[model samples]
Target: MVATTAPPPVERVAPQPPWAAGLSDVTASDASLRRFLHGLPGVDQVGAEARATMLATRSIKTVAKAWAIDLAITMIDLTTLEGQDTPGKVRALCAKAMRPDPSDPTVPRVAAVCVYPDMVPMAVQTLSGSGVRVASVATAFPSGRASLAVKLADTRDAVTAGADEIDMVIDRGAFLSGRYMQVHEEIVAVREACGNAHLKVILETGELVTYDNARRASWLAMLAGGDFIKTSTGKISPAATLPVTLVMLEAVRDFRDTTGRQVGVKPAGGIRTAKDAIKHLVLVNETAGDDWLDPDWFRIGASSLLNDLLMQRTKMATGRYSGPDYFTLD
Candidate 1:
């Protein structure tokens, strides 16, 4: 019988980077974040309780009015649509809503005007006195396929053109391929390129393919210094789902728990109806609490959602259905 050679000892792969390992530590100590989230009674569990405990019951009209006010107060970030090309039009549209009615303190200002990097200057110039921020989708947006130099240049150019926020798409391919370090490094470099502007790292959840990956990406982005972790670019087929949002919120909660850093979350794409918006609001209320409800920590990236909300509000107030054209393009 031939003697069998002894198998060579297997080499052990090293643990993940410091940032990745530290995610758990950071997420554990954020008691305030946990307290706020846990304290908010979930509508699913306490809807009846809420209805019974209200100081006074609200009529349908009152509920409609309240929804109108909520819609008006909502921070809507309009991502681009295929037919809408000019930044001027986007600016005009945002400007009309920027002028908050002094008579109605209930009406909150529009959040910000988001656009392609080339249009940042136009949006910034148009929204100069309007108090609306100019957000640019940079760093090989919707497809983090470019070289590091190109991504940095893209981010720097957007900032130089007056972008208040840079929404960068992470390298999903690398992340999926088990190259977490590559993803982490890319996000850090882009964050550095952002300068003082806020960085929204898009994980494109639909493409991530699993809740575990979504959670991992969320932690990775936060650890890599992302100011916000956004879901979807709205360019893909399957965009923003409730389950995905749940995973992300958990990640945010966990991140804050450990690092004491407050990271924002934005759910973009396929969020069209008022009921859908309310569901997201409910999620925020339950998962992240009152603190994250504001535009500072949360936002809805939509194109036609505002118009539908506005139309519904007008109908509820006037008791008549308004035509689609009721909302002017500008």
Candidate 2:
């Protein structure tokens, strides 16, 4: 009888991270994009708006309120995106991110200091070893009308300058014109250009014209490998409304259900008061579930929201209104 030998055992392949699974298949062609995106469930404006309004009424008093305030501070992307964004301004913002309130060491620091790509190095230098991250906005920013080459170069420069996170704007014109594949390709290219840095794709919801469109854009960005889906650039009006944010939260929730990926959601612009920030937290808690309550999975993109959160936190601690005078403006 001939001796029989068992074949060598096959090596088991490790599973891809939930976020990366099925991405290659979806991005293969324009037909696939249309089939996937158009197949997503549509958003109901009235229902989403009503849900946000109801959540806005959630009341958190005393200890719970204070906890929410601190959490909001940690979720802030302390932003300063003006043409006059000087190195001095960037350093000042970095200082605030490091020490939100010099008077009280108990107060938590902001999440990151967001600045133009040119000022990323200054932010990185100032925030070094302090636990605060440096985030830069690239890809032609608020208006993504530039060529893909220019956008990729802009993103690479920020990454080379040590930006910990890259906030890139999608080509709104392409998305609006039914060019879903073009937008997806751009996001994929930018995600590649970002290398190891986290990528946040801005939908600029204000320009999308409808909740359905915003939902579509949100899904498109996530499918293209965006770590976070941002609502706006804060340069336009009607930025970061409650209803729009609710729609985004819903999209992310469904995405997680479908892909087992917990992508982040950022509602940028127009959220100035602590009350507004808390409302957003409630929306996140109730809608996306508490799994996304942490800073790693949620962010508030604002320049002034930090001060408001500080004032409220002080009020909760000491029985008096701290006012804007207490917190330094960066």
Candidate 3:
């Protein structure tokens, strides 16, 4: 084991980790960063898929299932990102975020309400006193095919609008073409642009096409000072899956072990069912242990998943499941 050094308290600074001890110069240049990222242990594709599949099958029923349901509820990033989004829609989403199931006071608020930069102010305003955070997807979200200037401006606008969190997509074009340093620099710049808001770096793993690339991207994001590394933008097919999330959970677990800076993991996109959310919680608990189980270290990005969680929560509390009509759609 390389003798790793300690990082300054993350509360005070955006920690740009020095790789690990002897590998301090890993991010010094393009070539070193590439070599270090590529040199890290390769993933066993079959084993990873099999392990994730096996873990997903583990069941949590009744009382234990209820606990997982609430935990998953609190981890949601209730999102509404669309070209047709209106201020009223954002306001409604914010209301749902603050009090997901209005009938159930025991139900916990979600982690945030994710929207476009233009909608941040409305979300922030509605969620002002509520513990629910306002997260705006910036840096040309869904498709990060914009210039650094544009991306930085997008991040700045969201933060200025009182967004508590910023979700930025990495340039898949740069990353796929072997420009690792460019991706790292962009995340660092966005993190700086985020000011005090937490930065979630979206990897868009579907484009990467492999588990090894996902692991590399996770490390790259953490090194570049992202508070959280996300799985996808939720606009594409094959959005957050168990195996992909398992690999990311492993990356964060290993990262904290080496750098002593605990970055978070979020699996966004396509996870709409309560069962899917619970599977992810099982994966986190079994792989990353209980620490990543909180809302701070883990997040599930979805708009419709909240309603399903509410339905399940109602079923657990009452003898029968609540009708889908009982919950307001997001």
Q: What is the C-alpha lDDT of each candidate?
A: 0.71, 0.88, 0.89
Superposed model 2: Cα runs more than 4 Å off:
1-24
Compose the digit string of candidate 2's lDDT tens values, residues 65-173: 8778889999999999999889998888899899999999998998888999999989999999999898999999979889999999999999999999999999999
User: Over the stretch 110-146, how does candidate 3's per-residue lDDT look in tens digits?
Assistant: 9989999999888988999899999899998889988
Tell me the alpha-carbon RMSD of every candidate: 14.9, 10.2, 6.0
Worst-scoring 10-residue span by lDDT in model 3 = 1-10
For candidate 2, the clash count comes to: 0
What TM-score fits each model?
Answer: 0.78, 0.92, 0.93
Instruction: State model 3's lDDT.
Output: 0.89
Candidate 1 structure, TM-score to reference: 0.78
Tens digit of per-residue lDDT, candidate 1, span 1-330: 001321333332443433334334333333522332333333232433343233123222356445533653466776674445686676665664574333344456678878888887878888887777888898878788999999999999999999999999999998787666677778989999999999999999999876667777887788789999999999996788776776677677656655568899999999887656666665665566556767889888887776676666666667898766756553
Worst 10 residues of 1 by lDDT: 1-10
> How far is 10's C-alpha from truth in model 2 (Å)?
39
Model 3, runs deviating above 4 Å = 1-21
